[model samples]
Target chain A: MHYPNGKKNDQTQKTLANVSKSHAFSNRGMTLEEDINAANAFYRDTGKASIHKKPTPIQVVNVHYPKRSAAVITEGYFKQPSTTDYNGIYHGRHIDFEAKETKNKTRFPLANIHEHQIRHMKSIINHGGICFLIIRFSAHGETFYMPAETLFRYWDDQINGGKKSIRYETIANEGHIVPFHYQARVHYLAIIDKLYF
Target chain B: MHYPNGKKNDQTQKTLANVSKSHAFSNRGMTLEEDINAANAFYRDTGKASIHKKPTPIQVVNVHYPKRSAAVITEGYFKQPSTTDYNGIYHGRHIDFEAKETKNKTRFPLANIHEHQIRHMKSIINHGGICFLIIRFSAHGETFYMPAETLFRYWDDQINGGKKSIRYETIANEGHIVPFHYQARVHYLAIIDKLYF
Candidate 1:
């Protein structure tokens, strides 16, 4: 599959298709973003949590209604998002996060984040919301729920001569590893129950 | 002054223009959406709140950058928003609201709201967020903060025999009156402090 812009995959070692067959999991499907979205919807429907993905804000410049049956959005430019991706109430506490999937097995690069997003995350923390990042190492099939507080520490340390990227070992030590499932795909909230609630 | 859509104002009242004189006033006298955006920015900067106006999603068909400095978005159509106008955390509680300003003096019309927004607000309330509407009766020089719970009750009651439009008198009694100011233009958070905190 063609990766979106700003993503770097190890083209030499292995492809995602190869890993799926090795694992022998027929349910090895869905993008990380889609899974998390499904989980959120399930959570909301079950009266468990009410998080939602903010609609991707695109400035559409052109559309072609070919036959009135379907409207094709032809020309549009991506607008700078002014806020975090996902936000909602969970157990009467506000929850906010930005989800990203990386192909690197060794480390998740900080370049995946924008400076404005860091500022936004800090503001979310200051306002007393449960903030975090969902990092999925797609190649190794590992996902970690790293809290904003931990992210803040590393982000600030970068300014003071810390590592440019967060290693898998460091993430394993500090971040909660999320379990994958058939229904509620990411299942990060299960970790939230054990760690937070 | 003509509105952004080039619609001429029918009422002669100059409330918004007069209110925009102060340096702290928001939007530099733009649309109601602009004022709310400015208020949100101020709120975020001061660590007061995390509310944001979701950008109006648009489908673009064409863009012509005739000049290097100016990227003219030539052809675009608005997309129906899937959520409420503003949502964020305020002092550990989830805050969600939609804002609308009307020139109508005696009653606030319900037609200004999309059915989907009403559904979204209901979901927000079901999941424990504080949901409401900021109704500004510009002609009367009054703004009222009406809670979503109350609005829902009225909406449900309308099916049984309640009034279609909420009277100004009813709004004055049931809603929190928002005070206008130089810096905090809307100052709706003052009501939030009283009601939620």
Candidate 2:
């Protein structure tokens, strides 16, 4: 059997390279994820939106509370989320969405998204809620607002033997490029105003 | 010093009774809360609205996995919600609301609500989302859908020297009674159709 040049009898070195590549960033300062988070916090604090990041769920088996006021978590296990990253009410509307950042400059791989999230989004849209993904391509320093409707179409097409992944060209053509700002760095609400309101 | 009904202490039985009374229900069957939850699950399975109760947030301090698949939580503390009871998307719109059942036959006390929740709902409204409250007066087996806009107005009026709580009369006058159905037990979407669509 033939293998790539990077692969050898010892696969550890190639695996390490792949892991590091995924983790490393060329962006100099704060990441797009951090900026969006800050913007959400600002929006919430100012009573503009009530959106929030769901706290990571954990299962606890033991705790040490030495004093009345202090409780220390001694053991725990993380759990998968049934919903998306953020959910709350905006403009008296139920708002639910997930945010993802990818380093790939050519195409946004479908593998990055889990099947559960797609199913969850389908349910959201069916029930008449606005659902979408905030995709940030860090390599190009660009963000796109891909509505759940568009995503659903692409998702269904894949099942019928279409493109297996969403190319950057397709995203640029179909998705709204979310312009950044000083206060609302992601400026998602701006896109929402145009699309929803 | 004199006390009402022969109770002299500040943290008297009367005070405690008042606190617990807000959460009390006369029905002895499966709790209304539980029934509503089951109904929501049934609705989801049938391609109805996607509504869910936010999992009770717990600050876990310890966890133990005795076996590979069996994990146990040993210690945790409850966390207060910054939002409302129920939130989701329904019918291409944002649905954000709270479900609160009150036993009082005459009035819905202001004490049943938290300040932060009121503030959160206000933000949801400012953004153009559909925000309201599902108030169930279990005594009469009646539920009312009160818009957050109306609730906020009453809340502000109370703060600015109006009635301390919403009278059952006012709720009857201003709120729509959510009709019960076999499938969508809550039937809140029907109310939304009448009010919004």
Candidate 3:
């Protein structure tokens, strides 16, 4: 098949192999995305909050509609998102945050976050919304909720030729360790309640 | 091309004709979507507000990476969105809304809105977020901002066999008439300032 942009779908064989490898990894355990999705569902179902992860942005090049079926997108490319992963309202306050999981045990690399995402977070904070980062250290099975203010300080330092990553100790001291529950997998709201409310 | 769900993209040849008809109409002037996009850009540029139209959701069926440019989505289906089109934080308030346009001269059809969208709007209102609908009567060149509460009342009435569409007169009475500005095309926020803030 050819896209409207004339690109051929000829690498499907190789892509399927990559897809299987990722499927294998997902089959082994829950990913941070899955955990956060579950937590968001819990919050919604219980009327605790109304948060949602925005759909991954895609730049559609062509769409084809069948006679009796839904419209099919034949060609597209995943677009880099310019905002945070999750956002909603809690207690009349706009809540915005991004979640990331890393295998690194010593420090959280700044490369994990995009400059646009940092700018988005800065805008959210400036608008008086509650903005933060939920960082999960998978190696140590720990999650921390670091306020955007703290993150901005580190990000600014990096621009000034400072450390490129935040030390594990710094995050441990400054960020709130999010508690995990069976239903609410990543219970970051509990920390929000204590800190903000 | 076929979606993963075994749907073929065979109707494009027929749909293309219908698309051109709509394109011809849109070519006359700016579409409601374009106007709102321009207004959003103006709002962002002036630091007046931070709002964005959510990206259209596409359910990927197949993807291909040709070891050159970005990964190409070879097959996908356009997913029905579960929430409103536009949402963001405005002055510490969670702003959520959907915009629709109709050519009908007298009544705005409720069919333009989906069931899930109403449920999502209800949830936002329950969570204390600011929610509304922007309806444009293209035939009359008029736009109005109808609060979620007013929309819900009409929606519930429809369930009880009330009017299937809201009359233009009723909208004029209950909704704020949004004025047009050169820079901020659909100046709905002006009404928001009076009604909300």
Backbone clashes for every candidate come to 9, 27, 0
Model 3 per-residue lDDT tens digits across residues A104-190: 899999999999899888888888899999998877888899999999999999999999999999999999998988998889899
For each candidate, the alpha-carbon lDDT, in order, equals 0.75, 0.73, 0.84
Give per-residue lDDT, candidate 3, residue B170.
Answer: 98
* Per-residue lDDT of B156 in model 2: 90
TM-score for candidate 1, please give it. 0.78
Worst 10 residues of 3 chain B by lDDT: B1-10
Expressed as tens digits, the lDDT of each residue in B90-109 for candidate 1 is 98889989998877788887
Best DockQ among the predictions, by candidate number: 3
Which has the better lDDT: candidate 1, or candidate 2? 1
TM-score of every candidate relative to the true structure: 0.78, 0.69, 0.88
Q: Between 2 and 3, whose lDDT is larger?
A: 3
Chain B TM-score for candidate 3: 0.87
Q: Which window of ten consecutive residues has the lowest lDDT sum in model 1 chain B?
A: B1-10
Question: Among these predicted structures, which one has the highest TM-score?
Answer: 3
Query: How far is A31's C-alpha from truth in model 2 (Å)?
Result: 5.4
User: C-alpha displacement of B35 in model 3, angstroms?
Assistant: 1.2
Worst 10 residues of 2 chain A by lDDT: A1-10
**Residue-level lDDT for B31 in candidate 3:** 66
lDDT of 2 by residue, A98-129 (tens): 88888899988776677788898889877667
Q: Candidate 2 local accuracy as lDDT?
A: 0.73
The 10-residue segment of model 3 chain A with minimum total lDDT is A1-10
Candidate 3 global lDDT: 0.84
